[model samples]
Target chain A: MIERNGLQSGSQDPAPEGALLPVVQVGRPADVPRGRADAARNRARVLDAAQALFAERGVQAVTMDDVARAAGVGKGTLYRGFGDRAGLAMALLDDRARAFQAAVLDGPAPLGPGAPADDRLVAFVLAYFRFQADHLELVLESEAGRGPGARLAKGSYRFWRQHVAWLLQEAGAPHAGTRAEVLLGALAADQVRHWLVVVGRPADAVAAELAAVARSLLR
Target chain B: MIERNGLQSGSQDPAPEGALLPVVQVGRPADVPRGRADAARNRARVLDAAQALFAERGVQAVTMDDVARAAGVGKGTLYRGFGDRAGLAMALLDDRARAFQAAVLDGPAPLGPGAPADDRLVAFVLAYFRFQADHLELVLESEAGRGPGARLAKGSYRFWRQHVAWLLQEAGAPHAGTRAEVLLGALAADQVRHWLVVVGRPADAVAAELAAVARSLLR
Candidate 1:
């Protein structure tokens, strides 16, 4: 299970040491226990509302005020929870990332543990491509100003890279680690945007092509 | 035969309409012809000096004043020729890019016209990886703050993408255009930096892995 690390103060925090490690807070103010449950509920509601609004109207058109109003929460609560629109986007991405991680960890075959490594690799590429295509706007917003390689520093990226490398290793691929980096580099958000948006390739077509490339690597 | 488009004014020019088209300048002041040749010589001298200084010391440590002094050009000439250090970096990269392009077009087999599609593709990837490894600093500096997808708009990127796509097509690969984008995406500057610098992979090893991936696509 993925641990919610709480809201990052800003999405641009430099790569923290052991960024993927789950740290449980040991102590807090006496009143904080009651507040934590409410805060979690509020955060979920805000993220749900933001996701719907972002889907309905593009990300740039939706404002923090709009998100707060739609979530039926105070603007103060929304701001306190997310800091800004980019922070909200990052949180939404984090939320989706955790869910995807869960699916890969414990869900079904192909993407989970049951399928052969090559099948799982193909499935992962297809699924991740869909995830990227679905959240392109949010990913771009969250990663803006952070350089291209900044994602490599994120826990989610480390997780993806490790998973891909493991799959390659399982398939007895030579230079698995290096090849995994190159494969994932091909899936970077900007590259996805270029393929799907700028080049106007169909999502299915792009995903299929990428999946083929993934399968090719297994050889 | 690459046409010198003269100084780009700045390297961050937005994707120009007919960006790769050759434009011929028609008219100038009576004295401008003499000034043009002098300007070309001065530009070459400054670039050579900057390249040497950058090679001697790292790109960051070499100042514009050092380049001007080393090249025997004044500070005004240095700034006038290259705008700033990033501009200078871009110009140097452009110079190298042109040379590479020429080699690919007219040089020997494997990288040139005589080789089979798969062989050419592998050769191109290997040669490009080496080019990227050697000039990582220059590429990063030239691309700073321009965003990750910014390179896609560059004429050089367009050229590379077209060449890869053509080679893929020659090999009868499906979805050649999309796959080429994916392949070139793997060779992105930041990705190369992450593999070579951050992850500490040997450049030759990375290049070999990438070449294998490229060759796999031909099947």
Candidate 2:
């Protein structure tokens, strides 16, 4: 579902002509053609177990032992699939990121591609805030210890900036790319989480204000 | 200096039809004396020490012991003076907050009193981002654990929100108070720190984008 949505959403770039899309494909030369049925099943089991454990005990508290037992797989199999906690966490975030990408890119108008730029931007920011609220610990852990939200990759960050940039361009921003990068930078996941979650305001309310701010900032 | 600026700025609503100037104390509460010179001097020394230590080690790493040593005061004296590290941090934030309040409320035109509502709002948001950058650690720690930023009452979160609310009302927002609350809620110190310090954007750039966004949202 996510893949289908991702592809459709990816096409929403009304770039002037032939602008390259920014998705980072990590699979490469040494990669095998495909996983066997059993391997795929194990992967799914591990992911399900990891998500449940993370939700219950938080990302920091859930251990590989806990995951192995919950998934009904041996510790060795679990390690083989995800290597370590960070790897498992990253895998989970990847699933979410892909899901989120699909929602914004292809799910519907407004959040997707069919609506006006201003409305789309508002929808996307709202969606982003909702996602952050739902996975607060996961997102915070992903970016913690090195300073809040320090580990999010540049490419991932660019994805958001690009989304905002597209909207800004649609909004007739004087400098779409640069302005999008700057404006969206202010509405980061950690920032939203801090305000709506940490600071105890309703997430939807803050998201609405953020959307309004985005509207104001863009052209 | 701040009192001088407050009178000069006149940026805020006139002080409730001759509400005694902050300088003209109408009443004094029990336990808190009208003023004490020695206590004020000690407070200044401790704050100066905290500022110096903050510059050297940043917010996270500095300890109360370090603060005491830097200030050439005993640990007990430090505690007596500021209660705890959190208290000390809040005091520092208070210093900046008070300065900011004076600047925005009374310092000069545009940010203070003389400019159009739109221009003042833009300047205020931009000034806010700059303030967050200047005191990143204290700002983050203030909103650190969870819930409302109640712990950091020493800072300008409430004040900023109220100011924005007033501006929104002046700019013709229906339910201006609620709108301002949402707007200020959208721009917490944690979010600004996450973007500027953690995400590595220049403060000025973030300010400009935010100012633009504020303009658009208000419009």
Candidate 3:
């Protein structure tokens, strides 16, 4: 239980809120889904081959047959492993996302916690933007068929929102829940891509401004 | 032009900025897409009939045949005009959306520009939520096939974003552009519906909290 600070009250940490620790589901034994070890190895080999092909020739030019040939696997194997081109793209996205989430959960300060609340908040926003900056194509590809405004429901998004909300509460911010939501939404990849790429703003400036805005919103 | 006083700064309205007038695409002679007047009337009649049917029986239960029968229009006319059942639903959504936008542009005080910028901002957030609350089904209907994160690109969203940005600039808020984007994103139909309906918070309280969050973000 996050101690209920009056939407306006203050609190020194209470001892009972163990489940609501600074570290979240991040450090838990990750439920990394897998198949038979040999089968999983074959899957990884196929994905690596597909990733290299995508990087070299671009997604549009690479076909399933090309992936099979590069992985040295049969077409039947590729077909059985991945339902289709889109499915393959999503699996690659999921593969990268796990690592990203892990880093945010347990790796380092600012992004991984143990920093001041404001600093942690700032780091999270910039980290999200940088991730999008580095992998715009993959991020966009993974989001291809989502319903309008389904953003709040994405698995990673729910975690980010909860993390931000908890941080804001710890900092004694009023309306922390809504503020965290707004902050996350503002840092959405689509908007970040637009501001960073299309609008030609320096990435650092946007991150700094976002940090300032986040501070302004906090009490 | 909108006066840019700090949220804590002072201003009795400065000289007018014509480009920044209260009226937007709202008061412009609405180009109601018209066919022959009689054709338009029949379209309206069919839509009204469809609306009643949808309200009486859920969307899934009501079919095109039923709509055509209720409207006294031939099945071919329904098919030609709407393309299919989902098309009819979208057309209905578009119809309501156009009205909503028009109201914001030209409607009475608080919602329109007659009120102070802060008041108008609050009204706009509440009004948006109410629109979603009243027509969740229609709004969701229109969003069915949208690509992920496409919410920011909707035609109405662009207009609302512009309107909110303009209001924020007028109110002397820092980072009006980014703040408005975040505010709008947080109030996205999906999040609003989840908090208000799924979470069982009273509509008014959520609206009030949203208004407070918007104000806090300003300056």
**CA lDDT of each candidate?**
0.72, 0.61, 0.65
User: Candidate 3 residues B1-219, lDDT tens each?
Assistant: 112110110011111211112234433333433345555555666778888998899765787789899999898777666554545665666545656777777788798869999888988998988888888766665434333444554445667788999898888888788778778877776667667666678888778878888787776
DockQ of candidates 1 onward, in order?
0.45, 0.15, 0.36
lDDT of 3: 0.65
Candidates sorted by TM-score, best first: 1, 3, 2
Candidate 1 pairs with clashing backbones:
none
Q: Which whole-number lDDT from 0 to 100 does residue B64 have in model 2?
A: 79
TM-score of chain B of 2: 0.70
DockQ winner, 2 or 3: 3
lDDT of 1 by residue, A1-219 (tens): 124434442222322422422222222222324345677777778878888998899887898889999999999888777655555777777656656777888879989999999889999999988888888998766655344466676555677788899999998877788778778877878888888888897889888888888877777
Q: What stretches of model 2 exceed 4 Å from their correct place? A: A1-50, A53-90, A106-110, A114-116, A143-145, A148-155, A175-213, B1-48, B55-61, B68-86, B133-155, B174-206
For each prediction, how big is the interface RMSD?
Answer: 1.9, 5.5, 2.4
Cα lDDT of candidate 1 equals 0.72
- What value does the lDDT take at residue B97 in candidate 3? 62
Better of 1 and 2 by lDDT: 1
Model 1 steric clash total: 0
Give the number of the best model, judged by DockQ. Answer: 1
Superposed model 1: Cα runs more than 4 Å off:
A1-88, A144-148, B1-88, B143-148
**Where is the poorest 10-residue window by lDDT in model 2 chain B?**
B5-14
| Model number with the top lDDT | 1
